[model samples]
Target: MISEEEQKKEGKNEKLLADLCECCIMLHVGFQVSPKKVTSVGVHHLLKVVLKKEESEETQEEVERAFLALKNIAMWVKIDKELHLSEIKEIIKYHQKHRNLTHLAYQYAWEFLIHRFYSNESLEIIIVNELHFGKEAARKLEELRKNVDWTRKEDERGKETKEVLVITGWMKTIKSYFDSCKLWNEEYVELIGSVVQIYRTAKDNYEEIRYWCVFSLRNAAGNGFVPVDDLLKSGAVGCVLEDIRKPTLIDEITHHSLTFFENISRRLKEKTYNEMEEAKRKELKRKVLEKIEEEGYEEIIISLHERLNTLKRKYFYGDELSLNISDYSVNI
Candidate 1:
């Protein structure tokens, strides 16, 4: 019963959809085969088409297809060995301009950037300029934190949980850049302070959030990036120590806390007496020991030592208990 003109219009629309799908498939194959050979022209053309869809009133199905295409292209570019920096910048630029995109689309764009350019110095500059260290990112984080209510059980499908997931994903991506090779610098102090504040305020039941905080702390503490004194001042060390001491702590949480402790202790141990004047070295060592004792590490170590001794005796003596405990206890 359709008119000829109406049928022609429908045919045109179907062809357009088919063409977009074909383009997406072709690009996916091209990138996988030879990413370096995939020129900007094809990418830009696809992006233009996608952006056009974004600006126009499109069907949800059409929009989703476009997003999928973009995500595939992004994944391809991310894995490319040649480092398509300009392509990454283009994606970020699109994200910055279209801040109203759906969470899934935005996450795709952000993931592309995080994977493609995290260790690149350009990322730091991009973060400072586009993300606005304190104003934009910090404000968003604080807003998300406030939205979460710790008194009630969290709904996995609720808005609060989704927001927390986004924040945690961002934290995990940022944590990777703070590894030993990178380290924390003075410029990042405010951002690091924000992370520490989040860690201190997060509820114990919110293990995902707490886990990333400790993960970031572990990286920040490594390679002597942040001085021991500064770390102590941030109260992160105390927070981690307290968490590890909890009777209900899980292995995953305990592992991260202990790793952070190990990083700090290993850094301190590297500063030999010959590296500094005797007075300064002794004072530094004394301060470290005092902090350890204050954090109850001394008791933990003593308990571990005693447990090891008991295990050694049981393993060696069977039930005899006659073997000299001194032989194993001396080294311990």
Candidate 2:
């Protein structure tokens, strides 16, 4: 099936992409040596690599490598960030439209690559809006939901490490979008139920996946645009409270859980309960709990106050609870 001319062309293109990756490595060193030595031309070459429409594994390999190289450059490059992000949006847009035209834009690897760009401050308004981050996030979460076998318990998942690769990667991808949420719309609100569902499903079986989902919730809860009403309707609070009650909870997960409660309470305080419609007020009270039960969730919250009185206190509580809950009793 192979012709000599085609074989030679393949070999040449493969070598070029390999050279591009090596050049990017050197660019990293060049930045380390003297930031001045890293010229705009290096970036121009890297950016142009993503535009390569060739469908070979070699091309995909170079695209992923180029993204890694761009992420490093983004950290220290003393250039206009908007210009960088603008070019990225264009490249992403191209792949977005063309990947469906029987091409490989690195498949799911693009999710990994896009998250690197999210660390930039421009994610708040520019790329997220243009790329439909929230909508895409919902779709990805739904795919994870359908593909994963939530009924299987952890120990029973023997020979299922392959399934885990799907879940862990997709969950990480979904969480990355929550890094810097500013603008909110119906698409963002649509995410509440799906996130809660995934957390509940993974709570018992997959610790790593559970942490990713909960941490994503924590990040979303931390922001000003958090839809308090949507969260209430979605049972997000109950899922988090369940996690907090876990006897095996680790310090980092505990810290994130506590922060979730803290941020939710702060956001709740900002709302005028007396002025809200009866439906919303009742929903908030019901979701957090009944009048006495409300105080109970608030009690857990009050415990958080004493528990997190200082950074040391918080760490000690989480550590002590995790380590000594059976050997000795502890209080928040």
Task: Give the best candidate by lDDT.
Answer: 2
User: Candidate 1 clashing pairs?
Assistant: none
Q: Compute the lDDT of residue 308 as modeled in candidate 2.
A: 48
Error of 2 at 27 (Å): 9.2
Task: Rate residue 68 of model 2 by lDDT.
Answer: 55
Q: Which lDDT tens digits does candidate 1 get at residues 1-332?
A: 11222246444444354344436445565434344333343344344444432443353334435544555555545444344446545655665566545444444455555554533555655645554433444444565667666554555424456667767865765575565223344445655666776776664556777888887777777645466656666666776777766767565555556556656665555545564554554565566567667767756544444344344344431122222322211110
lDDT values for all models: 0.53, 0.58
Query: Using Cα atoms with residue i matched to residue i, what is each candidate's TM-score against the true structure?
Result: 0.61, 0.67
lDDT of 2 by residue, 1-332 (tens): 11222246444454454355436545565424344434354455566666576767777777766655655555455545454556666666676666521112232434534454555556556545777766655665676577767778556866455445555655565556565556777777767677787788778777777887787787777676667666665666666777877767666787777666666665654545465564565466455544325435544545444444453355542222222121111111
- Per-residue lDDT, model 2, residue 165, is 59
